[model samples]
Target: MPMAADEIVSLIVAGIPDAQVEMTDLAGDNNHWAARVVSESFRGLPRLKQQRAVYAALGDKMGGVLHALQLTTAVPVQE
Candidate 1:
């Protein structure tokens, strides 16, 4: 079974406490998703490292329950 959008967002936020996560179901099947996350944790981190953190939060679900994730991570923009 594919993971729920809220579940995925919760996991990401749990991992990155300061993260702001927004999720969109691109395919409406809960399999394809796009996530835009802004986090202070992303500061000074490479893009790959930021993505790894998100993936780590999902555990084994990456290839199992979660099929495709389009992820974007960035340091929070200044107001």
Candidate 2:
């Protein structure tokens, strides 16, 4: 089964309470997703750790239900 974009966003939000997530289905199959997450939580974290947080949010779904995912994460810029 494929995961819905909402479910993915919800899971990310569930873990990173202050995150802003944008999801796109690269394959139009709902299984291949490209997520752009902007969060204050990532401010000082390394790129690998930032991605890890989002991946952790998804848990086991990463390989089983989600199939493929491309993620980009960034910290919010100060104005």
Instruction: List the candidates' TM-scores in order.
Output: 0.92, 0.95
Pairs clashing within candidate 2: none
Clashes of each: 0, 0
lDDT agreement with native, every candidate = 0.89, 0.93
Q: Candidate 1: worst 10 consecutive residues by lDDT?
A: 58-67
**Deviating ranges (above 4 Å) for candidate 1:** none
Candidate 1: which pairs clash? Answer: none
Off by over 4 Å in 2: none
Best by lDDT: 2
Give a tens-digit lDDT track for model 2, residues 11-64.
999999999999999988888899999999999899999999999998988888
Worst 10 residues of 2 by lDDT: 58-67
